[model samples]
Target: MGQLFESVVMAVKAIFQNKTRAFLTMLGIIIGILSVSLMGTAISGIDQVFEKSIESMGQDVLYVEKFPWFMMNDDWWEYRNRPNIEEEYAQQILDRSSTIAFASPSSSRRADVKYGTQAVEAVEINGTTWQEAFITSVKLESGRFFSELEDRYGTRVAVIGYDIKKNLFPDEDPLGNYIMINGNKFRVIGVIAEQGKFLGLMSMDNIVTVPLKAMKSVFGRLRRISISVRPKEGYTVDQAKEELTFIMRGLRKLKPREADNFAINQQEAFRQQFSNIRFAISAVGLGITALSLIVGGIGIMNIMFVSVRERTKEIGIRKAVGAKKSIILFQFLSEAIIISLIGGIIGILITVALVGVVQKFFVAQLSFSLVLISLSVAVLTGIISGIVPANQAARLNPIDAIRYE
Candidate 1:
């Protein structure tokens, strides 16, 4: 161990002696490691954000929809095949499912909201129940959410998003303020808590929700509705799913073996889908990183060969003085490893710093696993690249080498 440490120290000193040459030699490795680490960090951060978003949606609640969120095929063929998920069907499921706490059918429409001279355009107007705001974590920052009694009375009250509140009512309280949906007057009842932005594009805060009855009154017909249902506490998720499926199947009046019309989307499904995508991304990144390492290895091998040729007389003299072949081999190999490792360390630091800067601005998070993996790959590359040169140095003919010099 002591001998190995001494050899490593010597290798490091050699690296610093010709710093520019060493750095140039390690260019490929540095870029490769940096690319991989940065990609890994970004991927990890995105995965974390997705996970947090799903978790915030509540594990007990299932997001039932006709089409999966990440499905690639959104064309006519897929859409036609998908069963129509209507409000009536959602209600039937709610009535039949014994394991469910509350099931609410929701639908959205994007339209311009007018508040006297002020106007907010293309805002998502979500039509859902009072239970939706409570069960699906739609917290209010101020004012009051519409009650079940108000919903039953078909009240034209609106709950604005945090951004909407800021846009429409900057100076004053928005509650009980009258607003128009393309001309029809509605009262502002509540404002939602700030949910920031998703993917730096869509702001969750830039939405407004109204009761289902009010929406039907204003919009004049809703064919589809998303059902959000929470399983009762103390029940396993699978058990809840089974019960809900059974209830849905019964409500749809399908045969025991027949496929049901409604779909049950859960938090775990999103987790699995997102996790699979991330894994695929990581795999592609690893493959590319491997290719870069291979190229860098070739460069190392070429440089080591040149080094060995330049030091042929030294090798011969050392061998004449009883320096073993193993020691020579170890020295060359250690040099290669040192060069790659220095590059790797620098790459890891740069990537980590970049990730830190990104995390400061974004809600996502990057982790240390990226650095660990990149460093490991670099070390492995060094070992692989050094092997041939080390072996050649070890097997040098001392008499012939001395005669040539």
Candidate 2:
């Protein structure tokens, strides 16, 4: 321990003697560490964004649609030719399935929404039954969801999202007020809680939902509809999916050898797709980071060699004074390690600052694990890059080194 401390002090003195050169030598390491930290922060932010988006869909809900959510290489025409999933399937599933706790049919389109003089364009308008309140995890911020009777009678009662409420009724209570959609006036019965954005791509809170029958009456039955189903409290997601598939296949009258025309999608589909994309991003990012680190390691090795050459006479003097080769090796190695560690610390500080700025717009998280990993990489790089040069310095013949011109 005493020897190690002495070597560290010598390394520090050596670094202080050539501060500018040491900083220049560490430049490569700094850049490499910075790149890796930023990459990790971005990946973590994307994961957080994805998790938030997926939460809006609910973990237990299953979506039954005409087309699969994930289509890999399969011709679009194959899905295009498949039969459209009808809204009636929601009722059918509810009637036949014992595992399902709730089911609702949903359809959406973009239209201008108006309340008196205030208007918002291209707002998402959803058509769904009252059961949507149960199928989805969306909570009401104010007022109440439309009743079953309202849905059955095709009442023009509408439930608005947070953004819609903010834009249309920024100053007044939205409940009991009428909003215009496609030239038809509909009474607002409820306001959905703030849902934020979906994967930072689209606003989930800029929507208005009404009864399916009311939507068909106003917009016609031309738009495609999907069925959302949720399992009962005791049932598992897989069991629910199995039962739903059986019921859907029976409804479509598919033969034993024929594939079902409809697709059953769930949160796992999105999770799996996100995982694949995250894996690809991480793989590519790691490759680039590895290249940078390798370059940095090479730079360290080159600089260490130069350092050894310059200090050959000093090494000979220490050897002549009876210094052990191991001490000489440890001194050079400590210098290299200290330089890398300094670079790593600077990189971490920069990353933290960058993450702070990014968090205002995105969701970057600078985790402790990432910090530990980065510092460990920097230390390991130092040890590996310093080995050959340190050995060369240690093995130098005292007479030749002292006499070196």
**Candidate topping lDDT:** 2
Error (Å) of candidate 2 at residue 265 is 0.6
lDDT of each: 0.79, 0.89
Question: How would you encode candidate 1's per-residue C-alpha lDDT over 97-131 as one tens digit per residue?
Answer: 77777788889989998887899999998988877
Best by TM-score: 2
Candidate 1 pairs with clashing backbones: none
Q: Following a full C-alpha superposition, what root-mean-square deviation does model 1 have from the true structure?
A: 3.2
Predicted structure 2: lDDT = 0.89
Q: Give candidate 1 regions above 4 Å deviation.
A: 1-24, 70-83, 199-201, 318-327, 349-369, 395-397
lDDT of 2 by residue, 246-350 (tens): 999999999999988889999898889999988887887788778877887888889889999999999999899987999999999988888888888888899
TM-score quality measure for candidate 2: 0.94
